[model samples]
Target: MPLWTIYHPANTYSDKDKQDFAKDITDFYTGFGLPAFYVVVLFTEMAEPAFFVGGRPASDTVRIVVEHLARHLDDPDMRRRSTERLNSIMVPYTRDRGLHWEFHTYESPRDLWMIAGLFPPGPGTEAEKAWARANKPLPY
Candidate 1:
């Protein structure tokens, strides 16, 4: 499972912007073969004052924290590809404002996460594959 969290200042983005960000993020992860039901994204708006970068109140910036099955950390190429795509998707929203941002992927082992009372089958596993196949309204 992959869960993406976006933390940005309130005025930094419009409602539609947040909507697109979530959709784009889910698409990015699902491209890796994960099912849509397993891709969770959240947009958390915070007051600019609530965030600080280098001890200075953040004025123009975005922060993305992604949590996924620890197994994903085993692939260096995937990380590189994902980061590149993240930059492309974010440039339109960050560049014009001269904003700074970082996307950090943190590993959360399968056992550490649960979905609907069951642990994820773990990425790239047969169980995960079967679950994806059984699920509908997704990129089956």
Candidate 2:
């Protein structure tokens, strides 16, 4: 599964904002062949005393850490397009907040992904294709 973690100061985002953010991100990932059920979004709030930037307390900073299978990040075009889409999601939330925002992505091995008691194959792989054929589910 893909794990998207947004880190910000506590109480910075309302519940509605978080929902919208998650929905937008899920839409983007689904377009890139991820199943909606397998994608996850998380918001982690840090208290003012715990939030920091440049080695000093900075509650205004917003940070995002995304973790996904390596297959998704292995293509240059996919990575570029995803970055742009992510920027679109963040702009509305971060604009004019006087906050510094950053996003970083990390890729883990596809074989490491385990869901529903099975090891799911990476996108566009022979194993994935076979599984899809057998399960008669969407190719994603």
Candidate 3:
């Protein structure tokens, strides 16, 4: 269950880029046995120039860094390497020497029962309906 929420200044991602990103991330997680229903990715764009450390404008440098990090998401070593690279390059390159780029990751055991219970049982044989009815009231 990896939910990716990307936030960056506007005009950052092309439609092709967005599609590729969604496909890659969904495939990656599902490959590891997480069902498609449990994984989601959201992208948000901001239009105004952002402020970085030292009061420098983010437009000057954020795009390159964002692209670089996005591409590296598939790398096995990205967890360690990406952090180091971002901290080293961004702190010095941005207007604010102390400004930090933020990335958040989270995982949780998927509650398939919760998802299944959200909808009525699909058409099935009488036995199937009986089973579903019998099991439907356990407070899932």
lDDT of candidates 1 onward, in order:
0.74, 0.76, 0.46
Residue 34, candidate 3: alpha-carbon lDDT:
40
Structural similarity to truth (TM-score) of each candidate: 0.79, 0.79, 0.47
Candidate 2 TM-score over all chains jointly: 0.79
lDDT digits (tens) for residues 1-140 of candidate 2: 66888999999889998998888877876665556666688999999989878889987889998887634665899889878877777787886566678998888887777766667766767766565446423333
Question: Whole-model lDDT for model 2 versus the true structure?
Answer: 0.76
Q: After superposition, how far is residue 57 of candidate 3 from its true place, in Å?
A: 2.6
Strongest candidate by lDDT: 2
Candidate 1 Cα errors over 4 Å, as ranges: 122-127, 133-140
Q: Which candidate would rank higher by lDDT, 1 or 2?
A: 2
Better of 2 and 3 by TM-score: 2
Residue 23, model 2: lDDT of 86
Tell me the lDDT of model 2 at 31.
68
Positional deviation of 104 in candidate 3, in angstroms? 3.1
lDDT comparing candidate 3 with the true structure? 0.46
Per-residue lDDT tens digits for candidate 3, residues 5-101, read 6665666567876776677666654454344544456776755555353676564334321322112254658767745643443343233533235
lDDT (C-alpha) at residue 117 in model 1:
69
